[model samples]
Target chain A: MPAPTRVFLSGCSMMILLIGSLAACVQTAPPELLEAVESLDRDLVAIQGAEFAPTEYARFVQDWAALKGRMLAEEDVIRWPWEPNPLAAHLQKVQEEGEQAMAVATQRKEEDRRDAEARLTLLDRRLRIFNSRVDEMESRVVLGQRPIETELLVRQAHSFLDQGLFARSLQATEQASTLIVAQTALLTTELKRYADERLVGTWRQMARRTIAWSRTNQATAILVNKADRRLTIYRNGRPVVSYQVRLGYNGIMEKRYQGDGATPEGQYRVVKKRDRGQTQFYRALLLDYPNAEDRRRFHKARRAGAIPAGAFIGGQIEIHGEDGLPMSQTLGCLMLDNRQMDKLFEKVEVGAPVTIIGALKVSNPVALALADLEQFEEG
Target chain B: MKQPFICYLMVSALALAGGCAQPPTDKLTTAEKAINEARAAGAPTYLAEDFAKLEGMLTTAKREIAEQDAKFAMLRDYDKAEQLLAAVETDAARVNTDATKKKEEAKAVALQAQQAAQEAVKATQELVKKAPVGKDQKPLQAIKADAQGLIASLSEVQTALDAGDYRVAQIKAKAIQEKSLAVQAEIQRAMTKVGAAKAQKDKQVKKHSSR
Candidate 1:
């Protein structure tokens, strides 16, 4: 029974043990190898949070997937057989590539973040300046009538910045700038047009003639430039002093007829001097505004239908002191601050020659721009 | 007689191996639960990449279990399947934590950006009030149009935020803030130029008057 039977049994057992061990070796993936692949996959996922270049990321992903597929396909290969596992080497290469990609992605994200932050910082500063300027312009010119359009542009620029569309943001900003500049020019021109127009050649000629007459007669004379808002006193043909003055509410145009609300232009002479309380103003120097030249012009205008036919060439035009109202509040009068009126009253008498002109100087660009703005605003 | 003994030995070894190789159901269930928790924690929105990786690991874990189950009872190794499931569980938990943190961060960034955009709009409105009205009228109108566009973009950003797209919202808000600021700067520059021009003109006038 025994010896032959025992030998056969021993050989069978040995063969079974060897086969089992070999199957185990071939069928199971090494724990370390599996862990490495999993780690690489996790890294790849982490890099997705970064703004990696799409093509590069895709290549990295493809390599990783290919390596993973090969590893899974060769799951039955022994890790440390007679030769090293081909799949393991491939996996290591893929893992390294993945790491590099992740690093690049992380770097790219940081750069993008920094760029965004920098742009934001710059934009914030610029916006603040623009906003303050708008406030100033409103207070100084438009008188708080904010432009709805500008508000819309700023909002758009903000939106572009939010989207990280720097180019678009800049475009909106540039448009806004252009608007601001144009508005500024308009405002400047509107505020300065009257003053600028007064400085023309015809007005200067009359003013020069008045000065020459005053010097020859050794008489006191006055020259008023409505545009410059100034009144100059001359004695014996020499300029003595000047004072800021205000004009009629509608003083920008030459006076043509009665109640035009315009200070009359051209040469005249003071017909009377009234003390305080004698006239509506603090003091008054009445002028013969409808002298021959004025009456002639008035009649021409009336005939040409420039003014109402029945409208008289109003008289009693005066250079008067303030009546506690705006400088331009008088009815066809040249108004002055009370202090200046007192000084002029002391120095002048009746029959003084007076010349009222449009402007004292040529119009500058700012004035022109302001005038344009005013025109637009009025329209 | 020896053949019977050998057969008995082989049967006992097979039985032990099969018993040990029962599907790692407990580990698989735990991993799945962790993955669900990560999803609930907003991993898909705030930590999308990490969440996706966790999902992949979970898929691999399930596949490994299926492979083990398909094998012959004597050859099956549930230990490897269990290990994969354990890895998945770990990854899922990490994803949940990371996602929560990222969500909070994204929300904060988005909120800050929204506030900045609002401030920019307000500033722009003020500027519009003071904008010039003359020859620059056309340009001013263009600026107004841009501002309107920005206001519209703000709504879009809000929509993105509501939809849980915090990254998109944050980006939009940032762009708005930057662009609005640039506009403000441009206005300031224009104002300065206008003022300087006026001053120079006044100086020239004074020189002429003195002469």
Candidate 2:
């Protein structure tokens, strides 16, 4: 009985302990497997895989949980040393799927970021281009509040981009672009006459005829091209000098009657040259506006009900100085800066022939600017 | 005398036959309710990263519960899932509080942006008072229009802020402020031209006086 029996029992217990230790080693996750799973987790979290690649992310998480549950449930099971670890293989597959999800999420987030950036760029470009046209047309009064509304929308879109609201940012940008296109269309319609080759040709012909007349008479003549904002002087059928000029507040319209803020169009003469302090607008070369043709047209309009009952053929039109003021607000006149006026006041006598036309050629500033804006709509 | 998971399974089996080892229903409900509250507090918007982490935790908990339910009833365990659910509840609540605080901060930032834009527009208007009236005829009308446009844009910032879209309001106000500064720069350029012209005129006047 005894010492020999105890030693045999101890050896059996030691054998069981060695087998248990080997089984636990099989259950333990390999270092590479642990690293792969952990890395995949980090990538998913970093790229917001749950939000961007929801389906794939869910599958990966389920697979990972199932693997974890199996590893824990089989912790005490015994297996042979040479048998492959199925858990390691399964973990590999799960990590691969998770990596795919990460890739998808990364690509989607990048696409959204690019989309938001593109919309921002387009909106910014449109704002700049449209604002420039509005400045040139002085058409803010005409389009009232629309440009302001568009600006607000564009800004809101930019804010949405900042807050990672790509869809909202794109929507707002689209809306602002629509407004800009509509306003550009309105401007296109308003300035269509400037694009008309026939109308432009007629105006150019009128200027040419006046220049020809200057050559025939061999006397000093003045030509005012309103669209170009140029006033040129001709001596002996050749232009000797030119100056930049300003017109009426509503300078685009052809003059009609008394108090109409429109510069008249036609041939005329400098009836009086009022020198320093003689006129309110610094200096004046008062033109003989409302000539025979103007009076005939005025009466015709009055009879034809195009003119108001009390409307009269307007007068006192002049080529004048800007009075050294910062702004040159004109009413039914062509105004030059004081520096240019001094030169003009000395060159022209009281009876010099002066011709005023809207433009001498096609492709005026207004026409060119409208075409640039149209490209945005077309693109 | 048994493995931890096996011992847990044995205990679960000995519990009530039909209602044995339930799937953390109360904890799940609390976590779901907290997540909804966090969403209402703007967690998705103001605390996106943290909210995303909370959502991931909820998903893991739900998946763990599903894994446990798939096992035989006698071997069911909700321990890991319940711990995750408890974490989700705590995290969701923290996310809600943090989001609320972030939204308030955004609102303050938006207000500051609006005030800055208003000040920029005011400064531009003051510059407009000195805008050049040259023969080209641009600075006065264009600057006035820009000033008016900026003023009108600021109202939109207020509307967005009232609607609780702080980012939109902030961006609108900031853009308007930039536009106002740009307009002011243009006006300054025009004023410089005006000054140059005046100096030339003064030189002429002095020459005439000497004569």
Candidate 3:
């Protein structure tokens, strides 16, 4: 080849190379940013699962900065060769990239704000839940249902007293008194060891005792004791169904917080029921915890913004089988042992009204004899 | 003819030098070095994890943003998408700090509870030994009951410390401390009984001696 022709060809080849590199940079920039954005998406999912860890956030910021740098650098390279001065184009490209990055960064900043706010909300929820638990414990100690440990202490003191240890007995009594005082102060000022006049009045007005009468082929009265925490499904006044249950740990007075673990206290109807799929936790009676009063309170509180949005109450309350856990573990729902839960599941219908009385004479011999008779008849 | 070969060799050398280029990092600015240091300190990993999430949300946000940007960009209005993106990014940065603060607070609560539990265990250990013991049983058994409570509380505290799971520790500690206080009172009662028993025995001995 001639010298002139060879040199011309080499120059042309170099020009094509420059043009190709510039085009490649332009094409790759947005896609790289998009890829970086996709990675950010995955991180967000992980964050949702476990709140936030410091290391996780640091990584997020680093990637964002790195991607921004790359975008700027690539833009500079593109613009470098295009200006009157060979390097002028690179400067121009860098400026363009800086502007674009500023825009991206600004948008990123807004996203960061929203995520932070959500995280704060979740943190606040956790804190409230913790405080509620502490408050509940204090209340329980104040109530008559003293912790089993305290009872053990009292029992131990009496045992020593029985052994003619008068001094020891006095000491134990003193200890018990101290504990009672401490517990009372922590719980409430108005605690009573015995059912006082106030309690009697409350119980009378509420009609703590009630009876559900069901009759078999022959007619008889089926008596229920609200105090005993048991129900006897009677046919023709003959008891057919008998089961033990743990009523509200706090004796089902008022519906508590969303997860206050309190049993709903109200006159609610059987709104819905699920039979077969009821897990060990519940056999499936969705009680209407939120009667008119509850709805009114909820609406009033919500309108005032006292509770956050999406705070649902009285939605999934139930009187069902103990979910795998012991009966004592239920938040506020009526709980029965597995064997009794299974049996109750079979007998109860969807629409059967479950009357939750505050107290009743469950030890009614008539009811017991009737249940025993039914068992004998079945056998 | 000799000069032609020399010139060709020089040109080839220059071309090769141009092709063998190093990355721009060699000429890194002070800001770039600082950024790199932060990245090396595991900052990048943290940021990546966080931004990856943002990027993900930004995809939908970006799409909506892009649509807005496109719609507005058509009318030469980049304001809406730009404003939205800016707002979202700031919100996103806050998420990390908020999460960290929660964990730290939980840890703090747990720490308080654990310290309280340790005190209770120590206090109970003393009371257990001081309490009266029956002749038939081992003295340690009496101590063991107290020890059992101590052990349970300690184990809870230890678990909390190890896993940094302070919430459970705090709860366990509070209950343990309450029980410990009650136990201390019981021990005091037992000591009084011991004193009375000795008094009664002494009275009988004096009566017999007088006879």
- Per model, kept true contacts as a fraction are 0.05, 0.28, 0.00
Pairwise lDDT winner, candidates 2 and 3: 2
What does candidate 1's lDDT look like per residue over B133-201, in tens digits?
Answer: 221222354455556666776887799789876766776677677777876776666566656655776
For model 1, what is the error of residue B111's alpha carbon versus the real structure, in angstroms, after optimal superposition? Answer: 1.3
* lDDT by residue (tens digit), candidate 1, A1-379: 5999999999999999988778656744356866876776676566563234444454455555445544555676664345565665776776676667677777776675566456555545554554454332222223222333444455556666565444555665666555655655544543444445444777778988999999889989999877667799999999899997766644555687777666788889888999977976779898887889988888898889988878998888898886432212466788777788999999988888889987756673234434444454344
**Better structure of 1 and 2 per lDDT:** 2
User: What docking tier does model 2 reach?
Assistant: acceptable
Best by DockQ: 2
Model 1, total clashes: 50
Which ten contiguous residues of candidate 1 chain B have the minimum total lDDT?
Answer: B133-142
Against the native complex, each candidate's DockQ, computed on alpha carbons, is 0.06, 0.29, 0.01
- In DockQ, how does model 1 score against the reference complex? 0.06
Model 3 alpha-carbon drift over 4 Å, by segment: A1-176, A182-226, A234-240, A248-254, A278-282, A296-315, A324-328, A361-379, B1-211
Error of 2 at A55 (Å): 4.4
lDDT of 2 by residue, B9-113 (tens): 877666645446788989999999999999999887786656766776777788789988998886788877877777778878888999999999999998999
On a 0 to 100 scale, what is the lDDT of residue B170 in model 3? 57
